[model samples]
Target: MPDIIQLLPEYLANQIAAGEVVQRPASVVKELLENAVDAGATSVQLIVKEAGKQLVQVVDNGSGMSATDARMSLERHATSKIRSTEDLFRIRTLGFRGEALASIAAVAQVEIRTKQPGQDTGTLLLVEGSQVTSQTPTACPDGTSIAVKNLFFNVPARRNFLKSNAVEMRHILDEFQHLALANPHIAFSLYQNDLEVFNLPAAKLSQRIVALLGNTYKEQLAGCEEVTPFITVKGYIGKPESSKKSRGDQFFFVNNRFIRSAYLNHAVLSAYEGLLARDTHPFYVLFLELDPKAIDINVHPTKTEIKFEDEKTVYAVVRAAVRQALGLHSLTPSLDFEGDVNFAPIRPLRTSTGGNSFGSGGAALPAPARAVEFNPDALAASVAAAARGLSAAPKSARCPRGPPSRPAASWRPFIASWASPCARPKPKCRPSRQLPRCLSCLLHTRSRPKTRARSRWPPRPWQRPQPARHAGAGPLRAAGREVGPDAHRPGGRP
Candidate 1:
């Protein structure tokens, strides 16, 4: 057989890693922003064009890298965070994976200009397809400026897989939102085609949410805080009523690092069980702090999945803490409907004083019109039924006021007793047939064996059975007399 073994080039390996690390424009944004944070940047600016497929720039006034480190940063597995295998388990930084920059450089044209503080000159390096074309000393600021252009230039198939500009821009915004939430003390600026979308300064967590989403959520947030001997939880959860139609607003971070844990997410939703509608979800920005050894952060290339050692306990604690916070906020309050005693239900028409007025303003307006009467009984009973907490369904088509026939199966899903959709009055729910079958039917159909009621009828294996006492401790005796031989002799007299 011919020689079959061959070594893959460094550039090819980096390109393969790029497939996992840099999936799209947003992926690049996530990595560069993380690097900026790791550089100790308090303020970071992000700019993009054509949803970052054409241009992407990140500028941060962080602790910039030295000239040599700047050049070495493009190499795969080149990182300042990890040195030994033990260091991987005790990671305290976000960009330790080291594949982020290398993968990004592999797919796009990358340019880096960075200078550490007190350095006479800065380092400027340019690379395309993981091949360095230029490296020189240059005058620059005391931080890093990375610009990625023509993403996936060599790979046309990957470029074709990218989404539209608007869709991709939204993804970039979402990434920026999570990062901004995780670090409220850091200032962030986002610009698209020179039009500023977000220019947020250092502010409180609440301020960050309001600024990022909008002012509409200002009054609907509730704060949550809990500190235990093992872990600490602190952040905000949206009021049950303020939940959105989508799950786009929920966020969870562990030690300021964003994560996606369904197990932990269920803990959040479980807390809002009775308060929120079945279809609705509550919004939360929760932060969890624990010892590094208790969880594993290396489960995924994205560093979003973390394994916990006692997840059940953590789930319960987080749920309870969020529930307590909601309770104190009184986010879900009872409804109150009462007539305004001072005002009539209907009033007489009044004249306007503007250009379309009935008369000149110089003439005093006519005396206040008399109040019109309104009958409380004029409303339909169906309206009153809702007030009494009863579900007011369709009026059965007003079928001639006679005995009604069964409706079509189309309505069966809604009226089914087991369906939870009809259980609420405010939010309308459409029942789905795809719901899982219940175990109640199986349990009821199974036959059960009958057993004695005595508590000790079935003794444990380790315990001794009690002895039953008869007339004597020897063989069977009749009336406390041993008559075995005498009885046999009398019967055999012959």
Candidate 2:
């Protein structure tokens, strides 16, 4: 019992910690990309192979670390971002936990080639499963290039838990988009399986969004900005019509770091309550800037969830800011009774056909049709006259002969009788000399029966009727020879 509580090995501890930091290839991608950004990298390149199961490399033109710093960076609880407990509460940079590299190295084969700007040479270090295999001097660029290969190599269980290539790549793209969106001033490029997926240059936030998503966003974006002593919210919100059925387009960044907050999300959505459909979500990329001490980012290992000291105040400000932006841009609906209802239609611009003299000289083309002015009074008079003429016509003259008394109500029944040759009545035969006159009269006048009432428009068809029901038996029985259930048996009679 005395030796039962032994200390865990450094490698084992780091591997266990890796469970929190490196959940999947996308997690590794996130940690590495943030580290590159924290190093003050202005230009970064990300390359992945086999959806990061085979390779995930990040090259950054940032301030590279010294040889000793590079070696210690892989040690647990060692970091250059913060120095004391108070520094943790006032944190401004990303990746301050110092556990990212240590945890990553514990589960994957890690290689780092780094050199400072003034250094004539560089240091190349390789570690396998948290064990440093080699460290040597090499000639390389004045930056850092870290490649994490064979992720979860030693942990078969973790490796097997990874999703398919398409799914993993989507996660990787999500992480990439988050970083790229948070830092518009930094140029970022991504290559997957030797194929260039994104090549974004340093630009403004609006331009960066258009470049990352597509040029179609250029017209859909509406600027949002609000400033106060407590906080400042600034970003872009898409037009109402641009809302999507999917939730992928929404983003919330606090103090320049991507985060997830249902409370804050509800605030933004409340601002767009009636503007979007129930199933649709509006596109927003909003950033909240406030004092770091007012919020705690250490509440989670991923740091995507934070607690604000004044959550309600922040919520109110965000909601109001979004609403104001929508109103200021005229994105919200409005009514104007005095506005003109008839707008001048725009004519299509004519193009030159190069044959006519007017077309060759770029002269104006003649109108295709004359413009007609609408007169309400004249239109009403013409409609009334047509109505009067229809009302004055005799009812008998409106329909042809050989039809029922009421043409409209009796057409279906008469047509059904005419369709059956046996039930139809034969037409009377006359001499050939009177055939033309009779045909003319039948075509000119409508024939109506003198009788006022009819029993049924058309008689029902004749068929073998159903049999009468017996007193005790179930319903009617068919008219056929009766047979018992055992009639088909071997010794039974028909």
Candidate 3:
């Protein structure tokens, strides 16, 4: 026998790991956008062609890496994020696992052009399937620009597993929106197929929300905030009226990292128990800030799922904040005081006939209608008079009827007897299946113990110890005696 254990090559290992981190084009979008945020980029630009199948470029004005760092970034498990296992419990950055760039490089053709402030010249590095094709000095800006082309080119099967362009684009849009919403202070832009989709400048969270979601949100947002020694919850939740059946509008960010948690979602929903329609979900962009040691984000490969040290505390804080916001919205009146017509300053009428149809004859429009006082007493009197007249009408005139077939006196007695519960006359009496005491003593001295078990003897109704159907098959016929039709009474009475 020969020893058959062998190690997987670095490139092969990276590709296998890529399957977990890069499931689709959207996965690449998420990883890259998060990396840009982690790099402390204030302005980021994203360009996609063919829904990220052919090209996905990300340019950022952040602290860029040097020549050695650029080359080492493509190697497996190479990172500047963590040094030991203790760092895993206190991770605050978005892309700290060190697998994003390596796994991405393993499956795609990637280009890197980066320059730091201190370096006079920039570095341009090209990689194909985890192999460096070239590395040289280039004239680029004082930041980083990474362009990924032909994603999954080496792994044809992975490319085949991708969805349609529209679906992939929607996923990419979702990731971009999440990042933009998470960091409103950072400017972000996206272009797809040479068409501008979004160009958001640095603004407050409310402005960022309007820029991405639309103007309708301007009126629907309600502020939610709660601060404690353990955690701090703050965000904007949509008013109950703006909630919908679709779930695309809900978001949750922990430490500025987007996450998905059904437990916490239920907490927010519980606060809106009676306010929401069935199957409808409210729109929210809640962010939770806590000490890094309170959460473990390394449980999953993508780092979207996390384990909290005390989940109940988080749930209580989220629920309380949402409920308080809803209460505040209720207290705020719906009317805009400034736009009320009643309080508007009256203007002088212009009696001109230029293009106004109302002033065609050069006469000012008629004065506005005057207010009229209503009399509730008069209205009530008229309603009562109408009710009195209706009641005075004869019943025959109100409901038409045909002549009766029989006299009322005849049917009255018949109905009374038929409707009576005792109308069905009972039998005078009938002999039961049980024998008399003298007969049983002569037949057998041993008594048969009474039992109401279903297997032995089924329980009887008020007078159902022996059904009428069993009358002809009774033991009286076997004893050669004609038992009179006198039955046992319900309570054993004569």
Candidate 4:
């Protein structure tokens, strides 16, 4: 190539750089949110449309820049965080990469309005595709409100690469959750399609978690804290049982800045190896604190990837801290060694198939049966119609009665025998096996032949009573037990 590196057009250079800094909508959210934090924002708001394809706005009450600084922020390699080569190794801020703003502005239409606290007026900058269209004086709040619109508008290829709105929204939520969790003291709000998803006031990490996730997490959290001469780790890791099938809940932040480190993530998962099911993922919001010099945040354009000097030590410490916290949490389930251990009796649904799907505790489930070609809903309607026709007939055509009802005590013996020593209630008398005989007597005598119990009992597996299988076909079979009443004992804990 002729003079391949001699000179690259400014717009093309920015677009090329954007590839590393803005991979998706989540990337934009991460960059903007980090900028807000770097600005010393105590409160931040994120609003998005079509998951930032159409718009992404981050409003922050931080130290807003002057008109000159605001314009310079959109230029490549223009940053306030660092000025010299040595500053690269001693990075402390969330955004040291001067590429985020330029990369974002290169692919989208960006509008920045800023005003310092004491400034009487603010500056409004309108930029599109790395070119500033206007920069004028305006009246605005004492903070910054940056809006990015029409993302990848000039880059059709990049625009085509975006995922669906729902998928992108989930990614945005993930970034918001990470930042919000790391800086729990900051008030954060999020809106999507004009509906408020989160409105968290400045609060403790635990409270912030509940606010971000939902109230259901209130009981599932366990606190973790560890400190050494070189590093300190603190935050909450969800209980082993509370893990999900997906990886949404895990979070790692170094010195209050969100980061992505598969090495550290593995450390967390390793700590939970035995406690969690193989397919489930534990939730954690851990914050690691250490000197800036020990970690390099400039390796990645987005600054989410960092390299630690003594990675192995950090990994071990993180793992131990998480494991120790879980151990101290009484919520950790314990095996009842005092009682008999029955392995084949029941396979408690250890991992759900959706959302929260991660862990090392999954009992290999039998593969599902292939579905046969049939429509059962139509069959059900036909059966119900036949029953109605029969019921409308004369008394002489009525079907014969079936069985009689049994007294409650008749079933006591089976319940008493199966009851575990760990059962919650106070001491109670155990019934005898003769209870089934009592039921037999009641069924033979007291129960009416024609009338059936009007109970809301769920249909039995065999009684699911499917359409008659073809006479020449094999016996209809299922791969797994369609759990009957006996499968899940009443009031039993999983």
Candidate 5:
């Protein structure tokens, strides 16, 4: 039997590597743009057709490549940025893996036109699916121009996985903004479907941000600069009031290379603890400058995520920088020098001048209150005089002592035998015709029914008087004894 394990073809190996490096059209655009910037290009232009599904091209005006170098650059693991393994620790430039160009050429049709400064002619090389089809010397301008066409043409499965045109365009725009922001001094322009989307000229970082994002960011930025022995944080942070609901405006760049770090982002958000609303993120374009050996940018395949040697220190520094910027610009939550109204000066209602108060014509203005002197002897004399002159209170009704439910066990025997004159029983009723029958049914009534039913005692003030069922019923005289004045329920006020 033949060996099951065998080496894959060069094209097959290149295609597999392409799956990691070239995720979508945005990945291709990122690689091409980075190469342009790394070439020391002062001016660069990007053109995309059909959201980079058909063609993605980058043109630059910097030092270009020669014919031989152009052909060699198509092979995997070919780069001039590093020499030895130690160089990986001090990587400062972007796109150093050397897999971008090779992987891109493996899945797309790539064309290159580049020329050095002293060269009389330029080199034009074309490759399709990792196979060189043509190599010739042509007349072209200085610097390099790489065009990638028919992306994922050889891999139908990968091509079918792409998103809509608008979504892909949005991704491509994101990569373009990152590269443009990373290099503020470099002039950059982007054209989608022959229509210009952004034409950012060489300018300062703030100006570049305003041009790239929107004009609304012009007055919202605040400068943030902090330098430490380990790291230096510098950039512009948006004012707290200018924060938005989405986090699309936040950016973190390490050594002029954009990256994503949630830990670092949290540090920034914490600085805006009470300033920003919940679920709202502030806009910031912070650049962290540190020794390359202290960070590892090669941790991720796309190099957009990095690992710091001491992340805590970096977080502290970033938080401090952002906080300083916010406080210095807004000067909010300041101390109110105006004293409290509750402690204002008070004036006496009656003035000391002739003891005059505000009256008809003698309306005298109130005088400033004066402090009272303490006199213990005078206070004692006044207390004695008031006690001697006090009058006694008039006697009223004496309330019954026992509980309404029943007398206490200690007083049961005494209360059982005790009897008051007012509570003496009346003689049994006799059917007398005069006095209309004493309304013991009516307590104190001259006219009442011959036989009245006993109503509830101590009538509730809220109940209405019932109409007479017979001919001679009237007033509270028809009801039982009047509930004298019970003042227990005032207005229920505290």
Candidate 6:
């Protein structure tokens, strides 16, 4: 039997730790930038080649380390952030575990060059596979510049698992953006394969946002601020119209460190329930400041998840603050219930003098005249006049010798003829034969057939005498008596 349970070597342990600390090229970028920030750097520059697969470098003008300190910094668990266990509870720096550099050095080839401000010389240390290859004196600036090359080179499996250059570069950009936003006072620049992607100058938060996101964000941003004993929330939230269909623009930072919290995000979304569409997400860069003791950042290796002492209270405060900001900027709809019920919209009025003026600036116009009430008799008279007009014949269409006029009593025969089911034979028209004025006018106005237009002025059927087909068939008939051919004759039987 053999004792298989043995301690793993230091190199193997560091490599395993690298698995958690350096998931991809973006992870390496995060660690290096945070270290530069923790070192009190006011300006940081990042350069990458082949999307960080070949090389990733960070240069910072911070307090450089001495030769001894530079050599010891590569060792595992070597850190200057905290001295005792109590210090962990009050941690403020971005990197605290001191394992980031060691883990990175295990899986990649790392080179560090640093020099103190008053030192005559500097130190350049190179390491590969957790083993220091060289440490020598060199002439360099009073700062630190670390270059990581051939990441995951020793671990072929990890290298093979990486994504394409574009995808990896996107992740790198995301990390860079987070750091830049968290520290707007610090100048930052990024270069990829000699092409400049970002060169942000030191500026205020709003200016930094517009610089990073573009000028279009200038009008979409709304300021949010709230302070309390437990926590303080402050940041900018996008207007509802600026919301996006994707979820990449939302960010939450606690103590200037980015974190991911679904509960807190829900609080913000609930505040924007009616403002945003169901599939859309609002853009926000919210930062929460609270006592370090009230939350734990060491729960995860990445430190992007924190446990709050009173999450509910924080949620309420965050939601209220965002809602208030929207309302203050008039992004939210509001109504005034106290307004007068009879209030009417002001409109321009045209005066009798042909001048246009607003209702409030000019003399009030006279009221519209009331309409005249209806009169049945007058309406009936107007209708009768119109009917008479329709019956009148034009002067050009009149007979050569005007139709003979007869007594008004002659109208009774024509009315009776019009009411009959069968049409009566038309009577002859002659200057000697007279017809009522009304009948003459109606017969003259009646439309003749198209074929008869050139025949004569008055139709022959109404002009010459018509032979009687039967007795009493002329123009008139007695009541209860059948109309006959001679009914309309001068001496016809009743």
Clashing pairs in 5: 439-442
Error of 2 at 115 (Å): 0.6
RMSD of 4: 22.7
**Model 1 TM-score (2 dp):** 0.67
lDDT of 2 by residue, 75-97 (tens): 99899999998998889998898
Lowest lDDT block of 10, candidate 3: 398-407
Cα error of candidate 1 at position 362, Å: 83
Residue 100, model 2: Cα distance from true site in angstroms = 0.5
Query: All candidates' TM-scores?
Result: 0.67, 0.70, 0.68, 0.66, 0.70, 0.70
RMSD of each: 30.2, 18.2, 23.0, 22.7, 14.8, 17.2
Candidate 3 ranges beyond 4 A from true positions: 331-494
Candidate 1 local lDDT, 1-494, one digit each (tens): 99998999999999899999999999999999999998899999999999999999999999999878998899888899989998987887888977888899999999999999998999999999999999999999889999999999999999999999999999999899989999999999999999999999999999999999889888888999999988899999998877767888889898899999899889998888878876888889899998888889988988889899789878988998898898788764544457455655687555445334345445334566599787677554323322222122333321122123443444444334432222222221212233222222221223334544334535443233334456455333333333332322222221
Q: Where is the poorest 10-residue window by lDDT in model 2?
A: 420-429
Between 2 and 3, whose lDDT is larger? 2
- Candidate 6 weakest lDDT stretch, 10 residues: 418-427
Q: Which scores higher on TM-score, 4 or 5?
A: 5
Give a tens-digit lDDT track for model 5, residues 1-494.
97799899988899999999999999999999999898999999999999999999999998999888999999899998998989999887897889999999999999999999999999999999999999999999999999999999999999999999999999999999999998999999999999999999999999999999999999998999999999999999988888899999999999999999999999999999888877889999999999999999988889999999999999999999988887788634656679675676787555445545656767566665799999999876543333222111111211122112332345433333431111322332222223222212122223332554445656554433544454333222223232222111234111
Error of 3 at 466 (Å): 64
Tens-digit lDDT track for model 6 on 1-494?
Answer: 98889998999999999999999999999999999998889999999999999999999998989999998888889999999999998988898998999999999999999998899999999999999999999999888999999999999999999999999999999999999999999999999999999999999989999998889899998999999989999999999999999999888999999999999999999999899977999999999999988899988998899999899999999999999999999999899788877878898755564344446566655557799999999876543443333223343433322333322343344434431211222343222133333333344444333443244545444444444444444443233232434333454322
Off by over 4 Å in 5: 1-3, 337-494
* Error at 48, model 1, angstroms: 0.4
lDDT of 6: 0.83
